[model samples]
Target: MLGALAQAVERLPPARRWLVGLSGGLDSVVLLHGLAQLGGRVGSPGLRAVHVHHGLHARADAWAQHCQVLCDALEVPLDVVRVDARPHRGQSPEAAARHARYQALADQMAPGDALLTAHHRRDQAETLLLQLLRGAGPAGLSAMPRWQPHGSGWHGRPLLDMDRPMLEAHARENGLVWVEDDSNGDLGLDRNLLRHEVMPRLRQRWPSLDTTLARAAGLQAEAQELLAERAREDLQTLRGEAAGTLSIPAIRALRRPRQRNALREWWREKGLPAPNQNRLEALLQQIRDVGPDSGLLVTWPGAEVRGYRDSLHAMAPLPLLDPASVWSWDGIRDLALPELGITLSAQEMLRLHGLEPALLEPPLTVRLRRGGETCRLRGQTRILKKLFQEAGIPPWERDRIPLIHAGDRLAVVWGLWCCDLPAGAGRR
Candidate 1:
């Protein structure tokens, strides 16, 4: 087991540090032990361990203590992160815990660090079965990759090719003890049901089920790569005037299957959640109904797609903002606009062109456009709406753009047009 693990560690890309995800469970404990043995020989890259305290189980604190002790014995630095793992509406408990755990671990990684998990062949097979039951497409069926770039660093599974029995044998030979999460026996959870009941029955008939399913997942991964490559090629031709927007007519030119493939790939590239088949089909139907300059919005959890003026724009669901809301700015301190997810700084404004020195004075009012506002740009007094149209700013964004006011006349529009000031006017 040590020899196989050493070879696997050698295959990992060079990194400034390696973070082992120590859950205090059998699999993780064995993985950390093996890595500790290889530390002196493998040019040990700042070996350390992190354990996420999900606080979901009764023994969650105990688990953290166990991980600390184990890391201490191995002379490894350990970080225990506490996270809120409570499930949100429509989200399963398992999913919430997993999300929280990974998020906590990811926070501990730096640019050149890699987080290793002890996911073996059985885990891969179980993931494939779950994806299959969910009727997922090629990308989902591919299961987890051995390693992938995540956050500022990378995430890897070094024990991906090994079986659970192999890890158990190594643990026994080395006198290793581990904490067993009681939740694993709960049949209510889908993964537990599959592992404790369904898999054993299936394995009775097919002893090599894990290897077979893992192979199938590998093939699906290959298919996903090809699809992603094609999508990248198609996107270059279908790009719209705006960044991340797709040309509607170009998409319409493709056949239905290819359109679906390209759309999924586009979502992947944007790091947005993939739309289910029904949602994708509905979006396509709505696209066909859209006329030039007319628009429609399709929404699902975590993301939304909007068709506007011959383009499809995908993004996180837009936050609601009241156009009548107002904020006073001192023009000295940074102003926080939580609703807009941005901060406005007077210093940043001073670095830009077309701003009157008086615009940066005290008593400035900041608000969204309430319509009928006009500004002078290039010696022409134009309505804000017309200016937005000329600038190709979408209607949904017009109301969200921050308008800085000096008593009723517009002084500046954040990130867009600034009112033209006469030479030497309001200069300090």
Candidate 2:
């Protein structure tokens, strides 16, 4: 088992720091102990462990303490991250907790760091089964990869190919102790139900059940790679004027399966959740009949896909920014616009014409468009709507753009345009 672990660790790309996701469970305890034994072989900056305190179970605090004790014994650094694991609308408790745990881990990671988790063959098999039950596609059936780039760094499962019994045997040999999560016995949970009841019965019929399912997942991963490659090639030609947007007509030119594949890949690239079959089909249907002037929007869960002009845009649901809302900003300090999910940097104002040091004596006002606003740009008096149309900014995005006003005169439009401001406009 130690040899297998060493080989797996060596196979991963070298990282400056390695953070172990120690859950105080048998699997993670074994992983931490094994890696500690290898010493200096894990990462250049040495090994550290992180325990996510999900606060879901009653014994959550106890679990964190157990992890700290083990880390102290191993003489490795440990960090316990507390997170809100409460489920949001349409999200399962298990999924919410998992998301929160990973998000907390991601927040601490730096570039060139790698997070190691003790996900073994059985876990991979269970994941495959769960995805299968959800009627997922190749990407979902791929389960977890052994190594993949994650937030600011990378995520690795070094002991992924190892089985549960092997880890249990190692724990016994080393006299290692781990805390048992009482939640594991809750058959109400899908994974727990599979682990305790379904798996045992299935193993009776096929002794190599875990290995076989893991192998199937590996094959699906390979197929997903090919599909993703095809999608990338398709997207190269289907790209819209914007970087991440897709051309509507170009997408319609592809066959149905290829279109679905391309759309899924596009969503993946944008870090948005892949829409389910029904949603994807609905989006595709909209794309087929969508006119250049159509305001077609297809939404699911955390994301929305909209067709505007000749492009298809996928983004997180736009925030509700009341047009009446206004902000005051000093020219020298960076201004954060939480409602718009952006920061207006002090340096960005340098691009605005005629806004010299003398003009900034009075503070600037920022507001969203309420429509019927007009501004003179390059000596031409144009309506804000016409300027937005000329700029190719979609109607959905126009309302979100921060319109900077020098007194009552529109001076800038965030990244879009720097309007012509009259001399001493704000000081008027």
Candidate 3:
């Protein structure tokens, strides 16, 4: 096990820092000791131990102290962080605790640092079973990966191929003392239920249950990769103009199964959570049945999908705009619009002014117009709605399109028509 860990460390990009998560449990204690013993062989990445006190159990502080003592004996720097792990309504206490603990550890990581955890084959088998029972798709059934990016650093599960028994044996061989959580015996949590009830029975019949499940998870991961590749190819056909958005017409052209697969693939590509089957179905229905003029929006916790003309836009929730006010702009300098993540530079504004002299009036501002606003085109004033239709700018883009205004008078409709031109040039 230690040899495999040494090889894993050697394969990683050489770094001067490594943060090991020490839970003072048999698995983590063995991991810390193995790394300490293999220090010279692994090229010494300035190893340090981090213990997160979830504060859920009464013995949390003592467990943290034990980790600190072990780290001190191993001559590795130790840091202990306290995190609130109170469960929210409808959430499992174990899951909430783990989430809080990992979040706290992620906060401590720096760039190029690796967060090493002692997840083994047993844990992998349990995870796979839990996900399978939840009726998860390929991505979820793939279980935890060996390595993944987390914040500024990477998370490494070097002991993933090793079993719990191997880690316990190593700890016993080294005469290491570790605490066993009482909650591990509880069968209320899904993983615990699988471990205490289902797995024990399966292992009794097939002794290699853990090994088999781990292998199954690897196969699922490979299948997921193939599906993702196919999804990427399909996404090329559904590409839209804006980032993170998809073309509604193109999406509607796909069969229902392919559409759901494409949506799932898109979310996975963006590292966002996949919507439930019901939500995804509803989204597809809205795209197909909603009137072209009606605004359609479907939102989840971290993302949203909206239909705009022929495009289906998926993004973070639309920010609430202060529609009652307009930003003051001076012709002398560029205005930085942080809300839009865009800068209205002086050069662009000057270029606009040079194109249309009528746009130079005082109190000139940039703002979105309410529906039914009108502007004069050439010799006659026309409703902006008709002007957009004539210009061929789709109805959906009208709300997002920027209009240059001079106090109460509308100047030029950018990229469409100019109220006036430079001295000698005639309007088209």
Candidate 4:
């Protein structure tokens, strides 16, 4: 296992840090130990262990403490993260918990860091069975990848080829004690039910059930990759506009399965959640019926699909806007809004002020337009609404455009106007 771990680390992109997800379970404990033992030979960049406390069960804190102690004994740095795993209405508790756990793990990883997990062959088999029960297609049945990008770094399941019994045996051989997660036995969870009930029965009939299922999962993964390649080609034909948005006309021309396939591929590329069968069908129906003037919005738990002017746009669910609330900005210096990654600076404004006949002669204030506004441009005073239309700006962008005002009067209409400047000024 240590030798395999070394090889996996070598295969990863050059990294200065490795974060081990230590759950204090047998699998994670063995994984952490194996990595620690391999460290001297493999020459790691750095090592740290992360333990997430979901706080769902009474033993959660104890598990985190155990992980911290184990990390200390292994001479590895440890971080304990507390996460809220409470499920929302109509959401599965297991899914919510997994989401919280992964999100917490992601938060701890920096760029160039690799996160290692202890998922193995048996776990993959269970995942495959669970996906099958849910009627998932090949992609879902493909189980977990050995390595993938997570947050600012990468996550890998190095022991994915090893079985759970092997990890347990390793822990026992090394005198490692681990916490037993009570939730693992809960029959309410689909994976738990499959593992505790269905898997045992299958193993009784065929002792190599885990191996057989893992092989099947590998085949499914290969098929999924081929399908994904085809979907990418379909996307190239159907996608339109600068936003990487999909064209409804082009998608509609494709067969229904191909349309859904292409859309799912697009969603995966955009990092948005893929829609289920019902949602995809509904989206197709809406796109077919709606005209250019009408907007179609379909929202799932974490993502949304919107249609505008024969184009389809998929995105993570955006916060609802409160029309009454407004953000204020001063025009004197560069300002970065951390929430939006938007920067507003006066470099251009100052350059304009330096020009002959001064393009922006200001005591300027930057703000969102609140309607009933007017501005003067090129020897004529016009309604702001009309100016936006003449400038070919979209309606959604009107409120977001930073309007530069001088005291009570609207001055320059950023990137669109140099009001009050002479006709021959040649603004910067």
RMSD of each: 1.7, 2.3, 5.2, 3.7
Model 2 gets an lDDT of 0.88
lDDT of 2 by residue, 1-428 (tens): 99899999999888988899999999999998999998866444578899999888889999999999999999999999999999999999988999999999898898899999999999999999999999999999999999999878999999999999999999999999999888889999999999999999999999999999999999999999999999999999899988789999999899999999998888888899988889888888989987988898999998998878889889998877789999988776788998888887665565554344235535588899999988887888889999899888889889988988877678787776767766655333
The parts of candidate 4 lying over 4 Å away from their true place are: 1-15, 42-45, 86-90, 326-330, 333-343, 348-372, 386-394, 402-404, 412-428
TM-score of each: 0.96, 0.93, 0.77, 0.85
lDDT of 2 at 369: 95
What is the TM-score ranking, best to worst?
Answer: 1, 2, 4, 3
On residues 76-118, what C-alpha lDDT tens digit does candidate 4 reach at each position?
A: 9999999989999988887798899999999998888989998
Between candidates 3 and 4, which one is better according to TM-score? 4
lDDT string, candidate 1, 1-428, tens digits: 99899888888888889899999999999999998998778786888999998888889999999998888888989999899999999888888888898888889989999999999999999999999999998999999998999767999899999999999999999999899999889999899999999999999999999999999999999999998888888888889888989999999898888888888888988889987888999999987777857777889988999877898999999998888899987776788998988888855676764444344444688989888989998899999999999888888888888998776668788888778655554355
Per-residue C-alpha lDDT of model 3 across residues 1-428, encoded as one tens digit per residue: 68877887776655558888989998888888999999778576878899998887889888988998898899999999988899888667877888898898889888888888999999999999888888888888999888888758888888988888888778878899999999888877677788888888999999998899899999999998898888899999898876667888888898997888899988876766677777888898988888755777787766777676677766666566554546677655667766555566556644664443223666777787687777765667789888886664554456655666766676656556565433453222
Report the candidate with higher lDDT, 1 versus 4: 1
Q: RMSD to the native, candidate 2?
A: 2.3
TM-score computed on alpha carbons, candidate 2: 0.93
Which regions of candidate 1 are displaced past 4 Å? 356-362, 420-426
Q: Each candidate: what lDDT?
A: 0.88, 0.88, 0.78, 0.79
